[model samples]
Target: MNKKYLFIFTIVIVIFAAFFLLTKKPQQKNTDILINGKKLQVELMQTEEEKTKGLSDRKNLCSNCGLLFVYNQEGFYSFWMRKMYFDIDILWINKDRVVDITYDAKKPEVDEFESPRTIYQNKVPADKVLEVNAGWVEKNGIKVGETIVFK
Candidate 1:
């Protein structure tokens, strides 16, 4: 009788373990980007909702951190500093090369009517856009034609 009870307990434990393993959520990996051999840890904004809210309302961004917007096709992507708290530099990428760069985009004031907001657009069609802290372009010496690699 004791042996029978031990066998049942073992079966129950194995079943629970299997169930837990099957229902467990998978962990997400970090996405890092390399531009001109310099690395930047990025948060991907793939969906329209995510891209719409890109870096807005954030008090600050890390020096080596940025938002990477991935698109389906190359387009003239326009950006505005709406609801932004800090300045940023926008890099327009076509495939793996930097096509255009918008430097030192200042944050817009709360009163849009009083302080007319500036809209920054890529000089050429681009498939991806990277928004990093202001002066990042000059500090890193990133220029058009520089290659960007995703890791």
Candidate 2:
């Protein structure tokens, strides 16, 4: 009888361990960015796959956490809430250390990820864009016309 009870307990423990391993949350990626005089360590999404998967599953972002999008040239750029689980403030920058636009993008409440039909335009052409947690700009006093230096 003791042997039978021990066998059952071992099986149950094995099952629980398997379940825990399979259900473990994915690890977050990290990257470094510099804005103004401050250095920000943030999660990176450099590839197309990573960009598409940006902040979709995350429930929270640490203070000053953000995603930076690098483009080849200065041009008109747009972003939407597609697959995004959180709101962000988008800062558009030109190559000449000029901040052309700032956008406060709200995350979609619905599950379907769709791009906004009309692009949120920028005042100046942008070569790079930085998307940070919502209100991060206001909280950090990050403003337009301030230059972001990449280190």
Candidate 3:
């Protein structure tokens, strides 16, 4: 092989190795939640970091994977595409565990979609919010008045 070609091959191999070593698999923690007496095994996003990173950059979500957000007070809440890479369905819940509303959140794109100078709106009022893969709620037939218990 020519010396120049050999050097290029070596550089490519080094770059590939660096990329493989620098990328880490995301850690998924588990928690249990009950919906109308039916238990669901879900991944927990309890910490500030985890909550902030909620579903962002994830190429896919497991069938039952979800993020549960616990708020200090009940009010109209909204979420934005922000840094998200995939679309999600937001399930808004009140203190009584009743499903009050559902919103289809937009998927994040490569370009910035949020307006920097304006306040964005939330789709529903809620004390607690559950985010799942887009269409999960409809596919599972989850509806208003359904109750959720976190365990």
Candidate 4:
């Protein structure tokens, strides 16, 4: 009788283990950015903290790399060069479409530190924001109203 009970316990444990394995979440896939036949390996920022920190403090932004910000809703968003080490081009995107672009956004000046920081606002409401190396937009021939595909 004890042997039968032990066997039953072992089967139950096996079933529970198998169920847990089947219900486990899948690993996330790496995402890439594409625009006008140009591409960049990107780092996605979906959380408020990630968006706030942004590309600030980074010494340089690679020509083939970018920061992609995703928001929960479409709204008029503003960006600033606060704590940023270099300039970058900002693309305001909504529904994977380019809504506005801010070119060559400069870093905050030391003098401005004591005063109000300059804010770069998107011309239109956007749900996503992409920051790339300065002049990337012109070099790639990306234009307004063009759709940006994400993979």
Which candidate leads the pack in lDDT?
Answer: 1
lDDT of 2 at 97: 68
Residue by residue across 46-75, what tens digits does model 4's lDDT show? 878878888777899777999999898999
lDDT of 2 by residue, 36-128 (tens): 666777665667786666666677677867777767778887666765677778888787364754656777756455653434556778877
**Which 10-residue window of candidate 4 scores lowest in summed lDDT?**
108-117
Q: Listing every candidate in turn, what is its Cα RMSD in Å to the true structure after a full C-alpha superposition?
A: 5.3, 8.8, 10.9, 4.8
In model 4, the runs with Cα more than 4 Å from the true position are 1-30, 113-116
Q: Top TM-score: which candidate number?
A: 1
lDDT of 3 by residue, 89-141 (tens): 77777864655545466674556644322223444566777788788777777
lDDT against the true structure, per candidate, is 0.89, 0.72, 0.69, 0.86
Q: Please give the ranking of all candidate structures by lDDT, highest first, separated by commas.
A: 1, 4, 2, 3
Model 4 scores a TM of: 0.78
Model 3 regions more than 4 Å off: 1-29, 36-38, 113-124
Which of the two, 2 or 3, has more lDDT? Answer: 2
Q: Could you tell me which residue pairs clash in candidate 4?
A: none
Tens-digit lDDT string for candidate 1 (73-114):
999988888778889999999999999999999898778623
